[model samples]
Target chain A: MSCNVDDSDEIFDDDDDDCSMEVCTKDSHHSGPSNMPESCYVKLTADDIVKEQRKLIQNVVELTKLPGHTARQLLQEMKWSFENVAVLYYDDQDKLFAKAGISVNGEAIDAVAVRGSSGSFVLDQQTITCQVCLEDFEREEAEKGMSTASGCGHVFCNACWVRHITTQVKEGQAARISCAGETFVEGKRRRCNIILDECFVEELLRGSGGSAEILKKYQTRLIDSYVNNNPTIKWCPATDCTNAIRVTDSFDPSSFDTSVECSDGHVWCFNCLDEPHAPAECSNVKEWRKKCQEDSATSNWLVAYTKDCPNCKVAINKDGGCNHM
Target chain B: MDLKRLKKESVELQEPIEKCGVTASPIKEDLSHWKGYILGPDDTAYAGGKFEIDIVLTSSYPFEPPKMKFNTKIWHPNVSSQTGAICLDILKKEWSPALTIKTALISVQALLAAPEPDDPQDAVVAQEYKSSIEKFKATAKLWTERYAKEGSMESIQPLLDMGFSEEQAKDALLEARGDVQAAVEKLLSGA
Candidate 1:
């Protein structure tokens, strides 16, 4: 059965023309459904995912009057839920900022400024030391060499920052990389919890001469975080498929038909990420697969290597590989 | 980058600042593998013992947390008795580039002072720790004395005082493989 893609007009307005054109071109060749549900799901490419994420970020930016980076940070902290971010932002601005590890009033920055002004200054050539590498740099060098996040004033050398960001992104921590500087809290040095925004991480990586592969990894991780956080969107579980499926309708597990076809025509159950198994519950399929995994190897070995003796009725293995018994 | 940061950290740790009693140095000429020592904190079952730790730093030093495990076995809930695997947050997900090897070792020392039985690496040890604090303390103290205190003869002294001959006590201790209670049981069973 053909499912209309126009039902999700509110979310997929920009892709409407493209989707309708594809529908018209593929309508004649559309095959009959084979026990699959009529769930309304839109297949999304990497570009579509970015556009959707940008749309959500733009909505938050307009609602909160915050910069795009800050808006994106809030959306990410709230798991890309525009409604939750809007509600919390309007409800209690300071609480939301605190929860997201954002310091809008620049209290930390002001504190750093005070400390810098009070510290030693030699002949108008002020030098700052990076805590990570424990090296001193001239004011000019500090500006060119040191990097700090937008909301926080804790600074580290660009080299150290690049290493930190590269390691974090490589380890799949691209979405929520915090500032890797320590700040004095109650006279005790503690890690700064200010999360580095995506734009800042990208600019830093690009400006510091980071590798192109790392930037690509960071972009992929951002898309992954967006898809993973959204309840309606799921990446196709097929091997090497970069496309995703966005189910417009609220998934009802009790109905049990949650299978959808990706753009690559890979049919999979959105609920369990398994192959399309109609008439079998996701839980039952999971148990059956697990049982097969546990016992299949042993059963296969017994069938291949063992034979039952007629008189004793016990399974025996021909260990010597001899034809005559 | 790793070598520079690791060398700087190594130099800074040499200074006795606050003296948390944790020391680490590279084992090989290259600064990849390291040997660390943590003097057990006072007022704990591990007191008066020195715990050796095996540390291996990946190429991404300071960016990635160093891998560390106890080389000297001690009975503790958060440390695996057999594998020396530790269950600490900072060593895993809570690791930050801002933290140094010195700080991580200090955390491990602090972990020895306060064991979290709820989140344990050794299930049997955690069970004993939760079920009976006294028995757990006894086993921990015995392990510290036998393995971490630098001498095995000290563990044989009590058996010697208990009327067993030196050769008999030594054989029983060897047969039990440094387990004091097992050695005592072996001597008593006369097997």
Candidate 2:
């Protein structure tokens, strides 16, 4: 059924009826460019959405053997899809680890081997210099707080990591906290900018210490990554709202005016991110507004060059004695 | 992380640059900014010309690349003539903590010696350099001689004769790097 947006609330007001009541619908068979096969709006209960997300995160964590934050990061990096992550995981895990920017020795840290029987980060007794501070520390100390990129294994001391993380966090560069990775490529020494895994930063902050503000910022960034990375989900654009909605049929680009209200009554267009502006298509509204603003100069010129007729109520040019009704 | 370590790194950077004869000094009382001069590498079109550079370091130094820009006017494929921005890969995405201000400056100098038109900063310069190598070389050399250095003291005589104070003409000549046309504009700008 085409949702008549004039009374859109009534269409979604029946919470008792299961949106999943009908299965496997191929909506909009017209095959025209303007109308797409929009999936029936499935208003999932918030609890069910949370459960599905939790399960997805758990699956990623289990599969990658990465920490919770890093697992979420990886999942988000893959655009919240298991298929992409799984393909990369099986295709060539080394490249994946390098891309993820987590590693100990130029190799992907096999979770089983590292935590075997001990349930700890495996450390071999070797002193290595942290590239940031340029100080040599024991491997045990390295495990506790030192962090390195997965591909280019450059380790930095814990103090340095905390300071750097704090600096980057303050600078609003939470998304790309990686190794200050400089390497040789095609005989030229260049910056690699490999991605740093969230697990390493979390472990460092947890072990060495972190301020509540920084920790909170990291947590917020972690949550935001999901919404920002996933193409089909949107965080409710309401003040103090902690909810996000994921549209199942996210591929419909033509549904720019599709407004979906959250459980909190905060409604926004699913595509264009404005109010539910019915009786006016998104393109028309934009064009009308643009024309009004853009023609101000020409309108002023008209007022300056011509005078309006008094009795007839029509604009009349004084110079040419031209009058219009 | 602390002031002492940061100071140490800055000192380390200064010594290498000075030793290489590419002098750089802290621009302000705080070590946040630096000014550098690289005499365009010899045997290149920009030889005998000095180009000044601005360097800004964030608190996250050694971890992040320092922001560098040319304060002196230059004409080259990789350097933006208007903005004085350089488009070297090492200065950006491929930036590593391992690189110091010295290496970056050296890379820029090397860029003057050999520009990569395939990846260019100023598209016009890149296009000209690619399509006509001789024309590119002539303009680059002319710009080097025209604006890169303080022209001969004798060249200020004409400006001094143009109903201006001796000091004013000399100053304008220095500001304009001896380009007579530019020196006149500099004098007018002052007035």
TM-score of chain B of each: 0.84, 0.74
* Candidate 1 chain A lDDT trough over 10 residues, lowest sum: A114-123
TM-score of each: 0.77, 0.67
Candidate 1 contains a number of clashing pairs equal to 0
Q: In model 2, which regions exceed 4 Å deviation?
A: A1-39, A42-54, A60-74, A88-95, A102-130, A133-151, A192-194, A207-209, A255-257, A291-325, B14-23, B39-44, B60-64, B88-98, B113-120, B149-191
lDDT of 2 by residue, A1-325 (tens): 0112234223223343443322213552323222222353433343444444556666777787765545555666677788888899899887666565443223221111132111123445477665556567777766665555444544556677677677667656565675554555454566544555555556556656667788678756755655566667777766777655566654444544466555555666666555666546775754465458767776566657766454333446654211212
Q: lDDT per residue, candidate 1, A1-325, as tens digits?
A: 0112233224424553453212112334545342344445676777778777867877886787776667777988898888899888879989888678676333342123223211122223387767677678888777667666655566677788888899888878777887776544443334566777766677677767687889989988888888887878888888898888887654465565777776667888877788877789886885576457767876577668888674333568875311323
RMSD of every candidate to native, in Å, equals 10.8, 13.2
In candidate 1, what are the lDDT values of residues B97-165, reduced to their tens digit? 777889889889888988889887888899999999998997787678666776555678999889998
Q: List model 2 lDDT by residue over B43-162, tens digit each.
A: 887887888999888767766678898998788888887888888777765566656777778777877887888877777888899999887876676667556766735566788778
User: Candidate 1: which docking quality band?
Assistant: acceptable
**Candidate 1 collision pairs:** none
